[model samples]
Target: MAVGRNGRFSGLLVVAGLLAGSWTGFGQEKKSEKVVVAGTPAAAPVPAAPADSVTDGSVTVGGQVIAYRAVAGTLTVGATATQDATIGFDGKTLPDAQVNSPDKDKPEDAPATARIFYTAYFKKDAAAEHRPVTFLYNGGPGSATMWLHMGSFGPKRVAIPDAEHQEGAPYAIVSNESSLLDVTDLVFIDAPGTGFSRIYGKDKEKAFWGTDQDAHAFERFIRRFLSKYDRWNSPKYLFGESYGTPRSAVLSADLQNVDLNGIILLSQILSFDNSVDGPKWNPGVDQAYALALPTYAATAFYHHKLPTQPAALEPFLAEVEQWALGEYMTALLQGSELPEAKRQEIATKLHGYTGLPVAYLLRANLRVAGGVFSKQLQTDEDTTTGRLDSRFKGPDLDPLSGDAEYDPQSQAISSAYTAAINDYMRKQLKYGEQQTYLPGAYSDPSFSWDLRHQAPGGPSATEQEGGTNVMPDLADTMKANPRMKVMLAGGYYDLATPYFEGKFEMHHLQIPQKLQSNISYHYYEAGHMVYVNEAVLKQFHADVAAFIKSTESGK
Candidate 1:
């Protein structure tokens, strides 16, 4: 999720996070060690945090006791046998290695480039090289995976009463019976400078701070991970959230050498064109308005703001979709050219659908941005709605302000997740690192990101514009691997990455009609983090389980 300039929670993260890149062929032979040339004088050593102690744990699920081991450690990347991978490196073959061990101290002889921290859970009963392994990460470009790690699919989950309410502190974590472990083993990743991941040596932040570079780093990590654990032949899947959705798509396209059985995208934003148009209405395209209308209707319906509320979300959204594409699209296309009579008619309907006053709708010229709708929706109560999940509301200090003071959507869950992950690392997982865990870095310079990405097939301007939009790369990946399957999960209440945007991207993906059936979509009643709501999570768990089984069985 994008942390806004004023510390409010925004839509998809615009800032790019650091991503380490040392691309090497998974099957390539290891290079011989070379002498290290000391660069500048070494800085004084700071004592390392106590080493992570590998631990064993068991949880009972479905009447079965599943034994698992939790391993926490730093995985080294972007380093050559002797020299840093960034030093004297060509574009091709970024000969790199990854060492996932409990010890944090760097070996005197080992090459250190970047250190990535991760917490892994391996099922003891599963066959060594047969069971499926899924790699999970969240998107901020700068966000740690803790949201998905502690709030959703992880074995232990942070329990909050509701997304609309804050949790009382000294909060607690509960065993997630719906954890994906019931079907597949899981690994949660923390990219550089997030959580405990760090960059070493003289390598610049640019190495892992861009799109292609980030994907390449993940590719290196996945390859090295499979090789290290002897799971190269194991069935693989990528589970990514928000920005991680685009990251997953790009990684799927880039890892042509490594076969991925399936991909699960949560709160996906496949294209930036749709995302950038979310909070604000961008001119020249009816796509954004048409897509966002359904979410606006859903949020309005949830708050009972809609003049004519439907009994159910599905029917309400389905009706809104029709109007948004039909009358709404036509009126928006006309702009000022629309007649006063037609404008009044459309404004009335928009008010009915969005709960914004007809006069205000007319004042907006028939387009109400998400933020404006959020603040205006609850103006009577002198509160503002959340961008993440409009179901949540908070009082703005300055009620007269047009914008929301803060995102109640972010505030509603951030504390529970932040507290749960920190406590779990030291208490449950036995990670002894004294380093402060950064859930997200809003102001960190390293989090200042560049979105430009190298196109998959060749140099193309379409790929260059809005570097975060990886729809083309995803389409290319599907074309190359016709058998690769994708399951997209979106929230109807999610204004951040509206469900209709996912629908729009799929329609415009340009994949051959025959291969189109390989992609599937699911919708939830909750917002961006769909799993935060337990009822929705049950459906999420079931859908994921069925998808994993179907893909693994080659169905």
Candidate 2:
């Protein structure tokens, strides 16, 4: 099931909205402590995190710059290369998490942690001999990589049922059939202050918090990982959901500076402020209109099934985009004084476009919250309101007119997955630690959502800059490594990072049209985690397997 992503908790948006640090999965918190360095590094001063210095493209030496020192070392798989699975993040070295019973008699005091420890899952039975290795993470800006890690794709998945709100046993997670692992090696990196990752005092904190700083940190992390893994030449891909989607977009260019292949965005959110577009006085008022359009149509298609074939949605959306960007944009700009003629016209079109009544659009003045349509679209006469997520509706005692009965979608999305993450951490992970996974309020006020808007024309000299667009750099990588193939994935109903906005960047980025065929993007019907739909999962895995096998693009 997908999250009721639109019915955002405006307050929680502020937390992730500000830090831009490590927002993957649900959320993450890391303990930040600096380490003293000793010994010398075998390499030269890295102007940036050089990709070839360490194995796996990552390093954990104590000192920085030319004074490179080994604070951490490698622990190659002890197995007979029989398709490695388990991994451990023990400081000073990496280790295999092989265990006999798994349930230890008494778990030792958790080791003193350093370096936000993370693990990777390289699926066995290699589906592709020369498969592309994908790096996946979720979006919390404060989240740990665990969400997408164990919960979704990782080798050892979180224990949860496939459907929402399953009873008997808290959750049961298994190998994700939709996981790209069948064709790719997946690495989950914990961002600073979340998971085992942490801040090294205030100095390090400053660098990992803001937009630019966060990008640089991720850039450095990727470089170090490539070096540590010794896969600098391998075909590399990155995937992220929600906030992680924007992180992947920014990192696409950031990693290109150091050299990376291509990028994939899942439920993307390109700009913090733009996601909620509107006049300065009432932010997001305009964007709210656009965001509500797609899902409304999706619901309409779901309920009415007008055109018969689901594929028929494309023509309708093509028209919705035209109206939203054109007339809808124009009307929202017109405050109370919409000439009677234009009002009637817009109201009628709104009714036809979104299966909602023209009276509602007229009363709302073309500005309606996503929640309103989600419930109103399917509300019954006896039941005045339905759940916020039209996806989930149940009969209720209390009846309401304006507000939704409840946030069924949010609760459903949280039910199975949240329980699974906790189980996966304990059982499969063998981390004996027993702690409940806290799925933050769908709209917790504590989460950061407030940040200064980007300048009209991107960043200026006076303003700070970190992770912005570096699509051109990725283009350069393709130019250098013509052998590599790449893919990009987008979600159609994603209000956070509208697929249309992402496609616009290629126009802004300077790229030779001939080389463009190497990177191809495929869209899905689901909201963010397209894999949630078993049908989509079947197709997504097949496509990823084909791409990793070097058959994609006729290459």
Candidate 3:
């Protein structure tokens, strides 16, 4: 899915956008609360509450019972040091900053601040310096980390169909046998304005709602977390999904004071130009189409839509990947100059791999956009193939439309995740009893995102003029910390950020060739959210655990 100028998915939340109507389920009272606007009299300061709620929990992973202490809380951060120094970790204003002033009465006079929420699991009795800690989050740019919290490596997970629509409520929320608690302490964070996190003061949106600003907010949060928990010496790792992958890339570079042990990326898209969702808008960027072709073939093969079903998926995709980068890319580059015979030949090949009609392929000029492909792939059955996971299908909202209006995968499983996190946080973790847990911030009309990014060395004039790309930030981090390992994981059925696109970006990183060996790749037979499949979840858990253990030894 494309991350629009607003930093939200046009079709889905790079993670998965919540359905608009689901907002009512969170609570109606919060809807009445207003954002304190600049130039207005500041509202009476709310009474200070406990900074966090503490709970104890245990989960059985790989037949071993693990006990943990869960802390659900919010950490206040400011746009700058002056703003941050105003509030203490206890949510109380500092003594030096406490003063009655005429100008302070105005909301704009105070600096912008955000109370970033998080749920952290620390293994009981583990040595802080010896045990590894991994920070996990999902990406919408506007999305909360609830998906990773409720559906992936969390101590518990909401049980839904592996690749089908989940039936209504009474959904099973169960202990996750695949939980990563066995190998690392996990911290799942809600981005500012999502879940229990809240931003306030003057121009709060501009302060925290952009590519560069968001990474800085996370950097501050991580630094504050390490200090609060006194785990500064622990092996630290970052695990981010979808848009979070790009956030990790920038954040890894920003946190230069600390040398991170590793970064784990799922459903990655480091370069916005490589996304298939809106490549049509940027002419001459043919890499997106070529990189996405392998995923198209995988999806077609899964649905039995391909002209010839390959006996093995891995080998078939290998063949398609080779052709996509070679013959197919060459044809697309030729554009208007390509001979009719060559264009026809390419369309024929696309038909065999994508299962779309030859005429439709020809009409599209052999460069099918992600949404159009999702709509056309299963149009014969009057269904829309999923953009997040092509293994999922839902009735088309508009069969006659040029592209899919909604993602079938998002629609199929969003409710289960939303409900699971709400219930678990309140009833189990004992947090957010009075506040609304926002799955996304897009519901707020004031929510806006700045796409401009400052790379490692400095702000690039070229980046300011084009789509945001954090490949330099990641490459710089890897080169500076050569021992810092990176793992890229994705699903073959993921069209949102095609699995092959991750490989393409990693291969092209600006780092030295010798440093390339520090990166690893893993692919699943599932979709964007690979852990949605129980079978794949098992392998996902093992792979991640092994990676952490291998690096944690500090050899």
Candidate 4:
């Protein structure tokens, strides 16, 4: 479970990489769509949902100053109160088991055990339930919602000197005119154990830390949030990055009983079958290499490393995609049985596309893994391209190592996000949480996470033989909710969850042929966190705004 600062893999280098809108007309289309642990508390009663702390704010976007209300609050889930699992600086337990679940479907005596913390901004004058509401979160399995909260979708964003440089403090906070606030309401949720959220007990941590359980908790939280705010009638959307993409997919299935308008998957890693650095001929290697080739080409093109640079990006990408799926895939499927001359030809062609040396490609059996490419691509310059964003380069700490030492892309903007989130929560939003805001990186102590999901038998069954792969979950969700539309956004340089992998997953989602068109793909010139690139950020906003508009129009 490699997790990066914003949307990186659990152990992988940080790569990084929002919005909302409309309804009534789309509602006519008739359709649409789509955590944790804690020990069993004593006989203590469950608490009601926490009162929301509201603050008024205004931001001028697209020449309009939209007045809005920002509500910072805790929404309780489960059957008992949230306990402070924090130790007294020495790992001592501080249990506060008074929080309770408001399970309307269960008995009044039903228990509640966890509390979710969220910040919501809504246009004050807009129609309450008519405006679209997009719930946003980042994936670290351990990450908080801060990245999307302050970096992209929120009204205020952190200003960095440049996305490729270390944004040292004191960083500036500026208005994110590109924010989706103008088109939709936003609610940024800090996943349990991240940000101000907490579960009642240590034992409960395992429950919230897993795949299916995590989605269940979020589903409950969204239902409760809607009930509390009287937003059940609003057009709902889910926006997730990195690991959050899988969570979004599973959540869509969990909420299938409810109508969901759309889903936004940014920098998605829906399938974990792909490898970054490993033996190249494993069971999943063919699929992994095939999916990665186009991205390798994209990165090589970005750096002008390809033998013959194409004049334009899209047509060049089409060429790579065609090769990756055609001859490249056939060669990989042949494996060791292939003739040396054939392997040599494939290796030479791979070199032409990936900018990796033909000698190395031949040695690698014509498979150039991600980290290998990241380190070897710029060998002459003694630099390592970031696994998160190959466009960002750093010193080659261990030039001999197979992987990039650390993600320069993660380091580049970490300071700005950390400082901005801390300031925005306390100063502007008037949030009073005293706990540290965890930025869901793998380095965090609490980030020790579980990737297991309940066996196919149901939520209470044994583990599935193979580990987590949520592609089926997303496909099933789409199948069950045909009206729900999806926008899969990818950054050409995002090695962590390469754009080509997303395309592969979408193509193989195993849904109906008609349903296949339900998911659309968009590419950015940036990396995992495409919004970090200013131009891409604006384009992201525009693209997503259009997506939301389209979904509402049922087109």
Top model by TM-score, which number? 3
Worst 10 residues of 3 by lDDT: 20-29
Clashes of each: 2, 63, 1, 33
Deviation in angstroms for 378 in model 1? 0.8
Candidate 3 residue runs with Cα over 4 Å from true position: 1-50, 91-93, 96-102, 460-463
Give candidate 1's whole-model lDDT: 0.73
Model 3, 264-372: lDDT tens digits are 9999998888888777767888889999999999999999999889999999999999999999999999989999999999999999999999999989988998888
lDDT of each: 0.73, 0.48, 0.83, 0.72
TM-score of each: 0.86, 0.66, 0.92, 0.84
Which has the better lDDT: candidate 1, or candidate 2? 1
lDDT string for model 2 (477-525, tens) is 5566565555666556543344655554443335567766766777777
lDDT of 1 by residue, 1-555 (tens): 456545543443443311122211011112233345678345333234345458898766666678888888765566432333333221122435343321334333223345567788899968968898999998877678888898787788988877567646877798887787878889899876678776544343556755676777787777667866789888899999988988998889878677788999888877665652332423655567678889988998888987877888898788888888888888888877999999999989888888899988888788766667778888999988877777888887578887565678786677777788899998878784567887764445434455667667656533444324688888888888788899999888887778888887887887999887998999988988888888898789889988999897556
* Candidate numbers, best lDDT first, in rank order: 3, 1, 4, 2
Clashing pairs in 1: 16-449, 19-208
Q: Give the TM-score (vs. native) of candidate 3.
A: 0.92
Residue pairs with backbone overlap in model 3 = 1-496
Residue 133 accuracy (lDDT) in model 3: 91
